[model samples]
Target: MNTGEKDWDKKGWKDVPIAGLITEPGTARRYKTGEWRTHRPVWDPEKCINCLLCWIYCPDSAIQVKDGKVVGIDLEHCKGCGICAHECPSKVRAINMVLESEAEAEDGEKVKEETMREGEEGEKERKEERKGEGGNEK
Candidate 1:
């Protein structure tokens, strides 16, 4: 097939690298844009109906999925565009767009709660071990 060739450099344009240009496939993954987000989407696992609309509509592909269900939101690449929350069904209301600071506070609370629960469990286990040791000795 004879194809007409046009001059790509007719305007003296050089093939120089530019920021945010997709010169190579899958290059966008290297650049994390999550820092640019002002708000973050918080997913409520109990309220989610596995609609997958958020996964489909998310521009950042941050919705994590497993076994045909949404597992969580990947904050590493999530741009906090709120598209996932917006795409979520109104009745489900599983995804909520919260301020970054508020989300941080919520996350910190969760971590604290988890630590407390672990401490309690550890204490209970130690008490049980002590009782077993003391009963056998006596």
Candidate 2:
């Protein structure tokens, strides 16, 4: 049976039988519902202690645990419910709920900061190298 969305649109509700139709259990896995979320949970690995509390509290089973540790979040099935962030027991707060727009901006800021720091460190090292070479000639 072609249960695809295109087929349903062409068939229309009148032609398609609605009653007594039951899809297989867990069929909802085929759909990515995360797109409907307005807020997303951001994980901080440095603050996480592998307590697994988030995994236990997640309603959608979105928290991915592997080898007795949380590997990452399965965003495709996640509804951005923020349960994982709320359940994180770390004092540093391993998980945080941020607005999607703000999250992007935060990521950009972090990248820029890291780039600037690296550039400064590289410039200092170059200056030191030049000083060392000039001093050797004296």
Candidate 3:
């Protein structure tokens, strides 16, 4: 048969009669537009008021908190909808919608801060260890 020809009565391909019956599982599906914003929301804990608006408003449930503070975003599943940033109540804006490129720039800044914090903690631990060694002067 030619590719353009229609086989109306091909055994398994034949149309089956349905008495207006619906028998399909409700699967978790995403309404995709095939287009998405490049900007994603990022949280600044220091500026966050712990209002939880960001978490509540996130359509993707991509935001989470810890110790009553917004801590992280699961970027893997985030489609950068910016709904959380739009819902954030902070005047100074703890949550901000940033372009994918701009977010990368900010990620670099955060990495620097994390490295500093780690370095400080390591230094504090070393000081405590030295103090435990009888405040060794040698």
Candidate 4:
């Protein structure tokens, strides 16, 4: 018996070919592992100090650095590992892990509130202008 075949059978047929084994190396790029994430990282630009710690600690290399500053997080490749948020300096704490559903809801509410506030302010300005015109006409 050939030593190679004998060893393979002795291993309990573990050497059998896997159906979808990655024959081509470096093909992991085609897989988007972000879909597995239950929570997502949200970046608060106002609180970020551009320290680059998040960029350095990200295991998936999802942090986008531009002009020597962290511009944003790349969600496509981010696995929601929370490394960036956890590694962020305590002083800045610019990155936060939020539930995916909560993030969406919060964003919608923010836009609605901003729109209502702007409309109210515009109405106040128009009223002030009308009063000034009445005084001038008299």
Candidate 5:
């Protein structure tokens, strides 16, 4: 119903709300559909020119902006359509579509590194516990 500064009452059909009804508002914000995304748009800040072409082309409105500049992707609502990456200008190519697994793999590596560090710390604790009668809790 609230079309954001747009006078949609004079307009017809174009950009109309679902079922042409305005009973409930802000439904999109209530639910995050990005979990369905299989691939995600990754941005390179160094290469980005803040053109906002991606923002214009994105169907889910996942592109986030700040101060009239492109900032990042809102993964919570992104459906991994890759239109942002596809629409990115060829010369700039600031956006890249990467497999979700690959992106998570990079995060997994960081988690592995952190777990290893924690294991080292726990090793010292285990040794101290072994000195007790429990011997590391059986």
Candidate 6:
């Protein structure tokens, strides 16, 4: 008898099925060290079926459910892999992945540009006031 045969004593499956996919025999796959997250998951409660697959499949524990609604990522702990987006099985797809690049952040380059513009406007106004005062003194 083959030792690999399934034992009936084990619960559930009688035997493990063979996998169809196989890695290259002598190739080493390299992975990125740091957490990878280009996008975050956004949920729409109206469309959510509350199946909880997103919460269960998340390796990072990023998905949360509160008050019967689904929420994604703590940000402090979430490393977005789009796993939640992929796992969500609703026909309408309630969850969406949003990019979190520097351009998307609150204090990003666009905000800096707006602040600089405001500062320049203020400086111009101050210069005009000074010119008007000098003319009054003349």
In model 6, state the lDDT of residue 34: 12
- Write one digit per residue (lDDT tens) for candidate 5, span 6-108: 3444546655556656555434353446667789788898999998999899987677676778766776667899998998999999999889878878767
| Tens digit per residue, CA lDDT, model 3, 64-121 | 5556666666554467887788888748588787787776676777854664564445
lDDT of each: 0.68, 0.67, 0.58, 0.67, 0.69, 0.54
lDDT of 6 at 4: 33
Can you give the lDDT of residue 130 in candidate 1?
A: 43
Q: Cα deviation in Å at residue 12, candidate 5?
A: 41
Query: What is the C-alpha lDDT profile of model 2 across 45-112, one tens digit per residue?
Result: 88889999999999977776657898667655567899888888858689988886676577777854
The best candidate by lDDT is: 5
Per TM-score, the best of the predicted structures is: 5
Worst 10 residues of 2 by lDDT: 129-138
Of the candidates numbered 4 and 6, which has the greater TM-score value? Answer: 4
Query: Of the pair 2 and 5, which is ahead by lDDT?
Result: 5
lDDT of 6 at 113: 65
Superposition TM-score, candidate 6 onto the true structure: 0.44
Model 4, runs deviating above 4 Å: 1-18, 21-26, 105-138
Q: TM per model?
A: 0.58, 0.58, 0.48, 0.57, 0.59, 0.44
Query: Each model's number of backbone clashes?
Result: 0, 0, 0, 0, 0, 0
Q: What's the lDDT for candidate 1? A: 0.68
For all predictions, the C-alpha RMSD in Å is: 20.5, 20.3, 19.7, 23.4, 20.8, 26.8
Candidate 4 lDDT by residue in tens digits, 1-138: 224453454434455347535455433443445556667898899999998989989997777676788766666457789999999989899999998667657777774465346445543544554443321110
Q: What ranges in model 1 sit over 4 Å off?
A: 1-27, 109-138
lDDT of candidate 6 at residue 18, scale 0 to 100 = 42
Q: Which candidate order results from sorting by lDDT in descending order? A: 5, 1, 4, 2, 3, 6
